[model samples]
Target: MRSVALDLGVHEISFCEVAGGAVVLRRTVRSLDSLEDLLGPSSSPARVAIEACREAWAVHDTLRNWGHDVLVVDTTRARQLGIGQHGRKNDRLDAEALAHAVERGGIPLAHVLSPHRRAIRHQLAVRRALVETRAQYVTTVRGILRACGHKLARCTTEGFLTVLSAAALPAETRQLVGPLVTALEMLTPQIALADAALEQLCTHEPVIVRLTTAPGVGLVIAAAFVSVVDEAKRFHHAHQLASYLGLVPSEDTSGGRNKQRLGAITKQGNAYLRVLLTQAAHTILRHKSGDDPLRQWANAIDERRGRHVAVVALARRLSGVLWAMWRDGTVYDAQSAAVASAKGLRLQAQSIEQQAQSMKEASVKARRRQRSIDKGLGATRATARSRPVSTSRRASMH
Candidate 1:
């Protein structure tokens, strides 16, 4: 089969065509629109290779739509295939090397997220930016208050303003901190809008709902997992999912007896998703960690190792749970015995009400608090005004 490689760039793309282990054609096109001259519609379909980057998706889709098989090759390993060899690289060299790699075969490929998943990931990124920016403003207020000898109680981000109101900060201090507080008030509604948008997306996605059945796995984390993994079936099994998410431990070994070294996790994949998974693990192990066999197993690891090690191990395990849940279309079963779970999803599907009522029965606590504070999350809406409304502030409200 003919092999073609494209070096995608912001303003231009270098194209190379390799046939019979030699470069037969080369061209530098300023735009994908110019491809008709080089790869006309009547030309035979060729396998195309492109380095993984932001533009790779558009390139992949464009080539596939044009009747070409596209491979979004991994950028790091492609360097080994003579790209940028001995400190020399350019668009033409890169494109030729990619064409040669494609012709040679067995080049590592990157997963190209479907358009739907890509859209969701982009939306989630917007939401994360809004949330993290709000958090920074909130943190600034905390530092300023602390310097002023006013310590606020630990409260949810959404209730930070409420907590501030209860603190009754001095008039001069309020004036000094007024700008960020106003910013927070402005951001709260926008963040809420972002959340509402994501929630609306979740309504159509049954996988998000199903994944959250795992303990401590909430709506946002589930959405992130779905967006990143995109399709669970692409992965052969749970361990592949864990490895894809970079949960597996790093290893170094030799052929000799007992010559092996295992270190920290490779941490090769999405950092955000891994952080959420660890957070979920900590939440699970925080209370009644021995509540089930899996939790107990994590707890045992905790007893043998440290909290940090145990948390990561549990996160790794949780990845398997998520994959199993998605692959098997099953919810988590806290009731499954150790023996039963050894083979497959230790979980049997149950009704929504049944799970909820049973969970409440298991852990009954007082209801003094009417709300919850999520990590880096703030209030959905502004409540009582922190200071007397000024004419300028009232006008700015519009």
Candidate 2:
């Protein structure tokens, strides 16, 4: 089959078609609607490729419906296809290069989302934007108040406007932030409605509900996971799921001894879902009212490597756990996990005790050494005083 590449621009769409490693045709169109003019829909289905972006998947579905196999190339790897080189880049070059790359094959493809799941993802994105905008407005108003020796008491975002109204404030102060207060009041109800929609979605999607059975996996977290993943079977294992979510340490190894260079997570995936997972991790860590094997495991890491690293590690593990639960069609089993981790917990306890004992012993040794030095100094002073009178005999004679 032949290959085709599309570069969707703000005002123009550039496309290239290639067959047998030779260019068949290339053109620039004014809009996506103009695409049908260059190629016949009933012709043999070509392998179409497009870089992953906001419009990429929609175009993918459109092309697929028209009888072509579409590949949404992973944006992170688009450079590998020579989309941009030197200092020059344009729609025509990008489309041509992508077309040739598609013809040659082996380009990495982005994860494809079903239309239903895609709609869910878009809804979640909109909700996130709304929440963030509200937060920005709240922060600005709070900053203004703080500058004037006033502080707002803690309250739910929904109750923030009510709280502000009840707090004693000068007329000028109230007048100054009136617009932001209005915005917050407007946002709160919309956020509530968005939340209700998610709850309705959760009711219909059994997989999302199943995911929520894991601790710290709330409606939002579960929904985000389900929408982003689309299907559980796509990942063969929990580790792959975590990696796909970019919760794993990134590695770069090369040359001489091939030493692995491990670094922070490659945030090459959906950042929204990743941040949600991290926030969920923080919630689990802070919930001292409940204890479980997962919490115990995270505490052990916290003791060894501080709280920050442990939180990230827990987030990664939590992602994996969620994936496993979804894959196996089982809820989190606290008893089984606690039993499995009992041995490690015991070892950690012993290790912590040993470290404390070692520190105590070292402190005692340091005190003893200081005492010995003090005694030596006293003796030296006493001997020097006893010898001082004999040493001054010549001075007395003079």
Candidate 3:
């Protein structure tokens, strides 16, 4: 069997083919149309490996369609393969390294998202960009007003325009901030349209609907989770899902001691998903009633470790909880969460009680052993006094 590696570029692709024990083919192809010619034939499928990039999914899909086993390697992991360690870093070297990696099974493959999920992910990205642009414009407008000893009142997006229009400002200040306000006004409608489209998309997704049943998870957050996760079955447990979202604590241990130093999250996976979950956590903590089990759990954590820590913890827990709900095909239930909490508490209490009882029994045994030892010593002394000194001692005394 032969393996091929492609160093894909915007306008060109460098490929290397390995057969038996050496490089059989190494060349650069200018267009995707010529890729088939390089591959020889469609009947003889070859293992193809490529570093994951913006165009990776497209290339992978194309090659797969042509009967090639395409493996998209993670970009970061591919860089660590020591391809350019000697300074002669070029497309040919990279292609050869990738081909060798594929042959030796050293490449870490990336998850290939389905078309629908990829589309949703892209739409969410677009929405995030629009929202961020709008925020930037708003901040610029505020900064300009503040520089002139004026402060705009806190208001909604639509209200912001009204406030700008009615502000009693000098002509120069107005002119200076006019373009920013106009940009903001233009961004507002685009953001609203994106929100509306997201809402429509989420409305049609049953998984998103189930996710929304979780407190603090509205349409946007739910949709983001569904799109980012794609397949719930990918994670065997909630912990894995949470870890994938970079919500879990990082572990750093050595010298036979397994210590997990609580620090910032790993932030390894989709950053957008992490942000959405954190925002959802904030909403859950702020608006949810204390009586709610999830809220109570968060409140308990807040009491122990400040509010900010509680929010992050809640976010991490929320990721796991939502994943569990999705995996089990069940809706989030407040009562069930409460029951689980109570059961955990009961088990903890039982464990403490059993430990205390064992300690007490051990203490009693120690006391009995000490008493027996003391009694034996006293009996020995009595016998020694009653029988008098030994014959050798008596003779020495005489």
Candidate 4:
């Protein structure tokens, strides 16, 4: 069997062809195009291997189209298995290593998204960038306003840009900040356009449709979750899915015991997905509608610990729920949600009852104090009335 390996060197592409576990041909190729001239058409089919990189997928697709088996491996694993272990690092060695890795099945083939999926991801990415940019600009306006010594009143109707433009301020402050208002005005439409594009994209994806069916998950989050997770079955279990999304707790294990360190999320997966999930979880907890097990768990945690921990835990659970739905092809069930939410609601009601009891106790105490004061005042009045005319001067009265 013959195998070809490509090393995307810094300046040039290195090509190595091996047969029977020996290098039969080695050459430097300028581009993927140069492969045809370097290695002429062969009678026997050849397997091609490449290190996973930005260009790796393109090469893999092209070579596969040309009737050759192509394997794309993790660059890190390739380095370790081929060059790192051997203490040799060079394009030639890398190419040889990739070939060996492919032959030995040490390199698991990389997955490539379909063209349609690729287009969808690109659209999602663009929308994400626009949203981030708008947030940054909004933050800048808020900071600028804060610096001008104009503290916004609570519950003000004005947004950052609106306040900046409308708030009465010194001429210098207006001059420095007025242009920002205009910029925000211009940027608002761009953000709207991005949102519209995202909405349209979401409409085309079935997974997003199903995900949006869940309470607390909006179109942006559903779409992002769908995009980041192209396959549901990749995860062995729902917990694995949650862990992959970084919604799980961090573990500190020692002395044969596992303890949750209670820190920030492990954040071991896609950060954007994690953020979306957590935000969705937060929204779910805040919304008074529909029941969710994750929300119940979160609220319980919140009461015992805090809302912060509850929200994070809820986000992790949300990830698990998504995985369950995707893996089982099941829709959200009101019965299940009800069962889950009952625990949280009961806890909430119990908390309210406890608070009411405490309030009642305080009221009783307050009433008793008022009664004591009133009684003392009445006694003093009676004593004054009983006394002979006290209005006279003390020395004259005696």
Best by lDDT: 1
Candidate 2, residues 1-398, lDDT tens digits: the string is 77899998878889899887788898888877677755457667788888888888788878887888888999887888888977679999899889999988899888888887877787798779889999899889999999988999998665577689899999999999999987775665566566656555556677775566566766678889889988887887766777788878898776655577989887757789889988878888898335777788888999998998888888887777776666666555555446533111111122455445534543453355345445434544554576546547868877
- The digit string of per-residue lDDT tens for model 4 on 85-198 reads 547688888888777765666566555666656656677788677667666766775677688676654332124555555667778876776676656555555555555555
Q: Which stretches of candidate 3 lie over 4 Å from their true place?
A: 40-43, 79-90, 255-262, 339-398
Q: Relative to the true structure, how large is the alpha-carbon lDDT of every model?
A: 0.78, 0.75, 0.75, 0.66
CA lDDT for candidate 2: 0.75
lDDT of 3 by residue, 196-236 (tens): 56655655667776676677876678778989888887877
The lDDT of model 3 is 0.75
Can you write out model 1's per-residue Cα lDDT over 107-177, one digit (the tens) per residue?
Answer: 89988898877877787888788789889999999999999999999988877877887787899999998
Give the poorly placed runs of model 4, Cα more than 4 Å off: 8-12, 27-30, 36-45, 75-80, 86-92, 152-159, 249-265, 288-291, 337-398
Q: State candidate 3's TM-score.
A: 0.79
The per-residue C-alpha lDDT of model 4 at residue 190 equals: 55
Error of 1 at 225 (Å): 1.6
**lDDT against true structure, model 1:** 0.78
Is 1 or 2 the stronger prediction by lDDT?
1
Winner on TM-score (1 vs 2): 1
Order by TM-score, highest first: 1, 2, 3, 4
**In model 4, how large is the Cα lDDT of residue 270?**
72
Once model 1 is optimally superposed onto the true structure by TM-score, how far is the C-alpha of residue 162 displaced, in angstroms? Answer: 1.9
Question: Candidate 2 vs. truth: CA RMSD?
Answer: 25.1
